[model samples]
Target: MTAACLMSTYQPLALSFNKGLGTRLWDQDGREYLDAVAGVAVTNVGHSHPKIVAAISEQAGLLLHTSNLYSIDWQRQLAQKLTRLAGMDRAFFNNSGAEANETALKIARLHGWKKGIEQPLVVVMENAFHGRTLGTLSASDGPAVRLGFNKLPGDFVKVPFGDLNALEHVRKAHGSRIVAVLMEPIQGESGVQLAPSGYLKAVRDLCKRWGWLLMLDEIQTGIGRTGQWFAFQHEGIVPDVMTLAKGLGNGIPIGACLARGKAADLFTPGSHGSTFGGNPLACRVACTVLEIIEEQHLRENAREQGERLLTRLRMELADDPNVLAIRGQGLMIGIELKQPIRDLTMIAAREHGLLINVTRGQTIRLLPPLTIDEREVEMIVRGITRILKTA
Candidate 1:
């Protein structure tokens, strides 16, 4: 932190972790902390997982990068796994969630051209977080993120997340010009908000009726973070386009944009590309991450542990006057406070030896590893209760 050479885009926590296991981390002071944040949901199978470590070690000895001009076998395997899980026809790998979304938005524009619309507008929900890039930022719901960046990418229309009537209104007014609808299955940045029940199905029907593509952002909720492989699976309907990252590579930094049917054939060889994308190392590691998630049954663990955590939190904090709301699904969880307790992050670390995060100022976000055990769930419940009670 004292190094003046690095730019200060992030205000990192005071303590640095030296080692990690399943749900535990040891800091520089040798203080053990329960990592409920789980590296912000990147380590789905857990830190230093034996399989993940071995995969990394083996692939590093092999080929790391050979450029996209040639074919990558691991990349094809990773895409095959993702497409099977996502129920999409094809996938394109990128380095991060932002790039995944950027790919999705670009595909939307191309689909618009096929629909005979020159300036196609994609409808996005409010209070959603896509990414930091300008194209994704323009589609994002946060005004603060897009504040300094002027001239955002054009043809993006905003709509209330859970409002079906407002979407209908937009369709009524600008029916021909709108080419796609982009949304998160669950709004992660806006305090773990769930779209109203039947909202996604309704939107799917609407898109089918009007010939507009349905693009779902599953970067945070994909890869078994939710009980299902992807959050959209809960609704039992497949989307025209879907983007994934985060847990996909278990911290190796890989993302994929998937498409089905007509959307699948939209991109040609020269139309879109990435140099470091779909490299052997990242893809092999991602394939191992997926295998471990299934082998360990972390998806079921996410369901049971997440349910227990939420229920216990509600039971513990229900009587507390400061708690406003508690809502979540699977491992993606949140509890909103009546007041802004921004400093609670430090307090949780200092007092309870727990790593957690606060989003939207007042909402405490819990994105623990999907492999959390019953005992660790109890620990998280207690740690969060202490923070909420004292704050």
Candidate 2:
């Protein structure tokens, strides 16, 4: 009930919510707030969705978990669905995005080792975020992620994101040592930075020519958040390895590492495993989440609402001097300010009764639930516009 018991990792806002519905949250005092952050994009179908709640309640009553030693029917069904949607051949389950990315890194190392290459290196992008674990942290960029943790694995080669020439330089310099190139399709944590047009396709082609596995960390851009089953589909390209989490279970906490071609078969029986991964409850909930997204046509809604939000924000803030850029895809939108506004998130919550987030200091990142309607989108645009104009 108090912050004293928890670790000092996160400095959460002073407010706390007692309940949540589709795109809305209520505090202990019964004050309502529009949730644009969506639990940092984990609640794509919206908070406490009926179907998701039903699935969770039913699965809890039936079975919660069984370790990876046994065969899980739900896991098999979920895996089949996800791989089919992703165009990947196989999947390995984990508990979080960090674990999923760690699995991909391991697969890349194994792929290199099989070909008799020693000290395999994975090419990563600068300002890209994978996860907080040591291996994933090494693969990620930015000093905040790498600070305090000394002696990180030095096998990752960091290059500027969206720069093909830099990638080429890495290939030329570390061609033999490099086993894979890992990056986010859209850099989410350091603000919603999208890949340059045609960049993903070019990276896929380069990987094909250089014989390096192309790994995409789609933790934030996957599921129905990007108006597609996965962000890679937007570019019409497929990577050898892909990592997913955040929205897969719609807040149930499940992560997956999907692979195709040679990358699929690299993980042998004992090579990698998780105790709680792919359990019945998580898998069943994920299956329901996927079904809800498909049945309700949430992806289409995401695109439409996203475009509506983007256009309205641009129109409203077009003449504002403080606003620099407005960019987004689907429900993942960002409004970059000319300078960081201190305590912007707190002001949005306390004064405007809206939930939001700021990343890379200057970008107001919005990851509203995919289930939001027109009225909610309008509310978001209005709240954001007011905050920016006053700031």
Candidate 3:
């Protein structure tokens, strides 16, 4: 717990959970709390689901890692399953969201390289948070995340998320020099900023016109988290490349960048890889996660519960002067306050036994597990109502 023992990288709460199941978590003292955060959307199927636990345990005993030199059966099965779900032709596995994004960015660069472009730029949105690596951080936008990481890698151009005019301007100016458009369907780290309706389709059309690959960062929105296999599916557009992680492995550290069309064949043998990603253990757990999501109908569950939650919150907080707006799709919800509520998460957890996060200064971000039910949604609404009353 002291700085001498471990690096001070995270500002985590003092409370530690010893066990968790579904939407409930028990701290070290056996204090049960309604977990609305769900490890920031990592445990979409909820913590310690029996199927995932069994798969991890079985795979651990059978095999863990065999390097990228040999063929992996579980990895292949997972790639097939993910590509089918994602509507992408091929998948490249990596260790985290950052790595997945890194892979996709590289593919975009290579795509431009095939045409003999010297430096290709990818159009990213302002306030977008792709990842924390040097490559992803370059694609990402946010003052706080980029404060100390100066002179970061840059082949990325920025436009306001959902701003069609700005995007059009970028396309007009950059033209073929822009190789791709990489952005999140719903911006997660800078708060849950959903792209406007029909916005994605517009981007898809523009990408087609400019001959740029459209890469969607689905790290926080994929794996049935946003009530769909992929959030972009809601707009009826398939991205050329899609990066996935977080809920894909349900707390296991694994990620993938799926590609279609010419982008799919960009990476040949020895082009890209990860030492521990998509190993036997992680792939087995991911396959099990997919099976559980489908068998349990978690996607439909998320849509239903999310609508109920959003409706109830809007109704309950309608007249509150401090409430700015309530917005989201499926389980990815956000409550924007009129003033900064940075400490709201701490207060909710400490006093109300509910976990939440504050992002973009005043927005209360809630990403509960997709497996949550109507009853649990009711608890979440009640908890928020009680907490905001104090605010």
Global lDDT of each candidate: 0.91, 0.92, 0.90
RMSD per model, one decimal: 1.0, 1.1, 1.1
Worst 10 residues of 2 by lDDT: 1-10
Per-residue lDDT of candidate 3, residues 268-292 (tens digit): 8888888998899889999999999
TM-score, prediction 2: 0.98
Candidate 2 regions with alpha-carbon error over 4 angstroms: none
Deviation (Å) of 75 in candidate 1: 0.6
lDDT of 1 by residue, 138-209 (tens): 888776678888888778888999998998899898979999999999998999998888899999999999
The ten-residue window of minimal lDDT in model 3 covers 1-10
Q: By lDDT, highest first, what's the ranking?
A: 2, 1, 3
Q: What is the TM-score of each candidate against the true structure?
A: 0.98, 0.98, 0.98
Clashes of 3: 0
lDDT of 2 by residue, 85-191 (tens): 99999999899999999999999999999989998999999998999998988888788768899898789889999999998898789779989999999999988
Task: Return the top candidate by lDDT.
Answer: 2
